[model samples]
Every structure is written in C-alpha cells, then in structure tokens.
Target: MFQNPSNEAIASILKNAKTIAVVGLSDDPSRESYAVSAEMQRRGYKIIPVNPNVQEVLGERAVASLADLPEPVDIVNIFRRSEALPDVVREAVNTSAPVIWAQQGIYNEEAADIARAHGKTMVMDRCIMVMHSLFVRGA
Candidate 1:
C-alpha cells in the first residue's frame, strides 16, 4: 500500500501546477470531482474537465479524455475508481503530465508505480482542494 504524499510536497505540487486535467469530473456539484475542480478553479488553476459523459462542467468546456486536451496539462487529477486507474494513469504518463493525483479513496499501486517510473509525480488518495489551501495559506 502506498502512503499519501506529505503535506509540503502536495502543497508545492498544487502551488506550481497551473493547469489541472480533472479526469472523471462530473457535472453535479455534489460529486467529489465537481467540488475539487471548483476549488482548484477558485484557487486560479485552470480546471479542464475530462469525462465522456459531460459536454461541459463547472462552466468550462469538457474533453472526453486527457489526450483530447488542447495543450499539455501540469496535473492529471483522477476521480475514477481503482479499477479504472490503469488506463487514466497510462494516458497521463504518455501525455508527460508532471503530476498524477488520485483523489481520496482511489488507489492503484501498479498505476502509481508506472507513473512514477515515467518521471511523473504520483499522489494517491489525497484531496487537491485541501492541499491547495495549504499552499495558498490565508488567501
């Protein structure tokens, strides 16, 4: 089992990443993806919604996959289940995203190892919104 990233590292990653591709993001605000993406956007990172089911989310145009994004994304924030993590992590690593963040309750050691081996930072089962607050600090 992989432990979640330290607060300092998570804060630094969130602070430096300007563009976040939120995989599995939903249109519903009650959803975890929606809440995290909303907070990321509020904190000034461009939130790119990646979900085939939604055409748009959080007032921004949504892409079906990270591969479909217009340009390179700094972070690939995954909101999918453990079973769906492999493909998303593969795509994220292939895209050369600097960071791959698996949301709370989601974990895949194989996928995380693959990402890390590819020189990408992997943060599993951590909330980006919480980390963002640590970095932004009183903002």
Candidate 2:
C-alpha cells in the first residue's frame, strides 16, 4: 500500500505548483475532477486538461494525453481509477513532471513506485484543492 504524502510536503507542492495537467478531467462540472481543476485555475495555476475525449475545458485547450502537453509541467493530477494510474504514470514520467497526484479515493502503489523511481513526488488519495485550501489559501 502507498502512504499519503505528509501535510508539509503537500503544502510545499501546492505552494510551488503552477501548471497542473489534470488527467481524465471531464467536461461535466458535476465531476470532482472538473471542479477541483477549475478551482486550481481560479488560483492562477494553469490547468491543462488531459482527456482524449474533450477538446477544451475551463476555456483552455485540452490535450489528449500528458505526453501531448506543449510545455513542461509542475504537477500531473490524476482523476482516473487506480487501474489506470500505471499508464498515466508512464506518460507523466515522459514529461518529467515533479509531482504525480492521484486525487482523493485513488491510490496505486505501482504507479507511486514508478513516480518515486523517477524522483517525482507522489501523492495518493488526497484532494489537491483541499490541500491547497488548507495549506496555501488557509481555509
């Protein structure tokens, strides 16, 4: 099993992260991923939506995959099931993103291992918005 990141580490990641590639982000606002990524954008972080099916999200052009991102990224925020993380990790490694964040209720030790192997910070089963609120915005 993968342990969640420490509060301090999460706070640091949220503090420094400026570009977040949100994988599996849906167009529907009802989805947790959409809501969280949108909030991140509201905080001035650039949100790159990574969903093959979506052309755009939050007024930004969406990339089909992490590998398709035009610029280097600070964080790869994953919203898929645990079963999908391994592939996402592989793709994220290609970008050399500093952090791999699996949203609340999602965890994959295999993907975490892959991220750690590449020296990327791995956070599982935590909501980025919640962490940012508690740490940066101090809600």
Candidate 3:
C-alpha cells in the first residue's frame, strides 16, 4: 500500500515549487488537465506542458516528453492514466525535478516504488490544484 506525504509536507513542496511540468496537459480548456494547469499558471507557477499531441497549452510550448524540457522544473505533475504512471515516473525520475505528482485518481504501486527508489517525493491520487488551493492559497 502507498501513502502520500503529510499535508504539511505537501504544503512545503507547493510552497517551495516555482515551476511545474504537467504531463498530458491537454489544449482543450474543458479538460481537467488544462483547467488545473491553467489555474496553477494563474497562481504564479510556470507551467510546462508535456504532451506530444499538442503543440502548446496555456501559452507554454508542449514537449513530447519530460526529456524535452528546456530546463529543470520543481515538480512533474502527471495527468495520465494509472497504467501509464510507471513509464512517466521513470522518465520523471531521470529529470532534475524533485517532486512527482500524479493527478487525482491516478496511481500505481510500481510508479510509487520507482519514485521512492530514486529519492523523489511522489504524490499519488491527488489533485495538485485542489492541494494548492488548500495548502498554498489557503482557499
């Protein structure tokens, strides 16, 4: 069984993070990924969209994968399916990002194990926007 870090720890992660690389972030505003990433952008975090399907999202150029990022990010926020988490986590672990955050309802034990093995902080099955509102923005 996997458990997310304490709320205080999550708050600390959010507080220290200035940039987020959002995997599977959709161009469509109606998509949860877009809405959440957009909100995070509006809240002062730089959002880098990672989606091969889209050229851009929320004014940031969309990269095909985490390996394509121009610079290191504070966090890697994933909105992909649960089955896809391990591969994404593997890629994220290779990056300089310290935190790997799987969006609400997305989780995989393999992914969690991989992240933990790499000494990365993994937040599984949680909403980054909601967490930001609760812990960062105090909403």
For model 2, residues 9-83, the per-residue Cα lDDT tens digits are 889888988899999999999989899998999999999999999999999899998879988889999999999
Report residue 85 deviation for candidate 2 (angstroms): 1.0
Prediction RMSDs, each to the true structure: 1.6, 1.2, 0.9
Pull out the clashing pairs in model 3.
Answer: none
> Please, what are the lDDT tens digits per residue for candidate 1 over residues 38-106?
987887889889999999998889999888998788899999999899888999987857889998888
Quote the positional error of residue 67 for candidate 1 in Å: 1.0
Comparing 1 and 3 on TM-score, the stronger one:
3
Q: What order do you get sorting by TM-score, best first?
A: 3, 2, 1
Reference-based TM-score of each model: 0.91, 0.95, 0.98
Q: Candidates 2 and 3: which is better by TM-score?
A: 3
Per-residue alpha-carbon lDDT of candidate 3 for residues 1-139, written as tens digits (9 for 90 to 100): 7899999999999999999999999999899999999889999999999999999888888899999999989999999999999999999999999999999999899999999999999999999999999998993
Residue 39, candidate 1: Cα error in Å is 1.5
* Best model per lDDT: 3
